[model samples]
Target: MDRQDCQHLLAALGEYIDGTLDEELCREIEKHMAECENCRVVVDTLRKTIYLYRVEAQEESLPQEVRHRLLARLELEG
Candidate 1:
């Protein structure tokens, strides 16, 4: 996949993981993931991060450095 495709995949990642995306968009993301290992790794890692955040975050706090790293990786911090 080209850079543009990777950008689009990243843009859709949150909605895709949240199950808010329609099937067509999910299919497109899945197809792109099949062809793009880099994107796949990013998506897989981010998805896991989100899962852990939702499931365990409420019960316990993350290490400050780990949370910072995750936020940085997700581009959520400026």
Candidate 2:
């Protein structure tokens, strides 16, 4: 986190966690995470949260109002 490049890492973090980042970029992120303990924790927590959300999402759908609100908040409404 102390490194200015942490911003670059953060920008690509979602793709990194999703396993969709290009190989060289992924390598850079991995190197940053190795040195930045704070970023590592943040990445780990987000990954776990996403995993749990996917699991719960499979078990039950959100009510329509809630779904709309959530999607709107995420700017993902389409």
Candidate 3:
């Protein structure tokens, strides 16, 4: 797949993770991820982020340093 395909995959990633996508589409994504290291890393990071919010961060905001680091990593820091 080309860069455009990766963008398309990334666009659908949230739905893929939320289990809102069709099984066939999910299979396509998983197949793509299996061969794409960049996509795999993105998917893993997103999954962990979701897990953290649902499990750990649900009780409170992310620890201050973590929030700052995440924001910086996204280049969203002020």
Candidate 4:
């Protein structure tokens, strides 16, 4: 796959991992991945990173004061 094709597929990679991509798009990505080791590695790394973050974020608790301060800062910025 060309750079543009890889770029296009990269945007859909997250959706593909989440099983939210349509079948046709999934097939297209699969086809591209078959011939593109680099893109496959990109997809694999992205998936693993997202999974790791999900697990870590769930296991770790954010302090309530920190959460309130962040929300207040966002509100002020908005």
Candidate 5:
């Protein structure tokens, strides 16, 4: 994968996966992915990873240390 061509796509991919990216950019990313196998793999892997995390989070609580760190990172510990 040519990094230059993929740089912008990588930056927006998270937002794209979350459905928060704008329509025009999303279309462009989709078009790019159609021709770029590496980007398709990246997007697919992220989608699957996020899906698994959501499923597991719904079923189980985080360990205390993990929970504490997460809360602290998010500035929600207070």
Candidate 6:
């Protein structure tokens, strides 16, 4: 698979992980992942990160200052 194929599959990754993908697509993704270590790592990390976040406490909102700082950092990096 090429970069575009990876990008398309990446968008459906959550559904793939949840076992909601159609059989043919799931097979294709499995084949792609088996041959691509980078995609495999991304999928694994996303699953673990989501699991960690789900176990964390719920928060209604971030403080304004923290949000501002985060946005500033993201902008700088971007």
TM-scores for all predictions: 0.65, 0.70, 0.65, 0.66, 0.71, 0.63
Candidates 1 and 2 compared: the better one by TM-score is 2
- What is residue 16's positional error in candidate 6, in angstroms? 0.8
Candidate 1 per-residue C-alpha lDDT over 1-78 given as tens digits, one digit per residue, 9 for 90 to 100: 368989998888889988999999999999988999999999889888888888986888678999899999999986
lDDT by residue for model 5 over 1-78, one digit each (tens)?
A: 577758999888779988999999999999899989999998999899989999988989669999999999999997
> After superposition on all CA atoms, how large is the RMSD of candidate 3?
12.0
The list of candidate 3 runs beyond 4 A from truth reads 58-78
In model 6, the Cα lDDT at residue 2 comes to: 57
Q: Put down candidate 4 lDDT per residue, 1-78, tens digits, no spaces.
A: 468889989789878999999999999999999988999998899889988999998989889889889989889533
lDDT of 1 at 41: 93
lDDT (CA) for every model shown?
0.89, 0.91, 0.86, 0.89, 0.89, 0.84
Supply the TM-score for candidate 1.
0.65
The ten-residue window of minimal lDDT in model 1 covers: 53-62
Ranking by lDDT: 2, 5, 4, 1, 3, 6
Higher-scoring candidate on lDDT, 2 or 6: 2
User: How far is 63's C-alpha from truth in model 1 (Å)?
Assistant: 19
> How good is model 4 by TM-score?
0.66
Evaluate model 6: give its lDDT. Answer: 0.84
Cα lDDT tens digits, model 2, 1-78, are 757888898899989998999999999989888988899999999999999999988999678999899999999999
| Between candidates 2 and 5, the lDDT winner | 2
Q: Identify the superior model by lDDT, candidate 2 or candidate 3.
A: 2
Give the range of the ten consecutive residues with the poorest summed lDDT in model 4.
69-78
Alpha carbon lDDT at 78, candidate 2: 100
Residue 32 in candidate 6 has what lDDT? 88
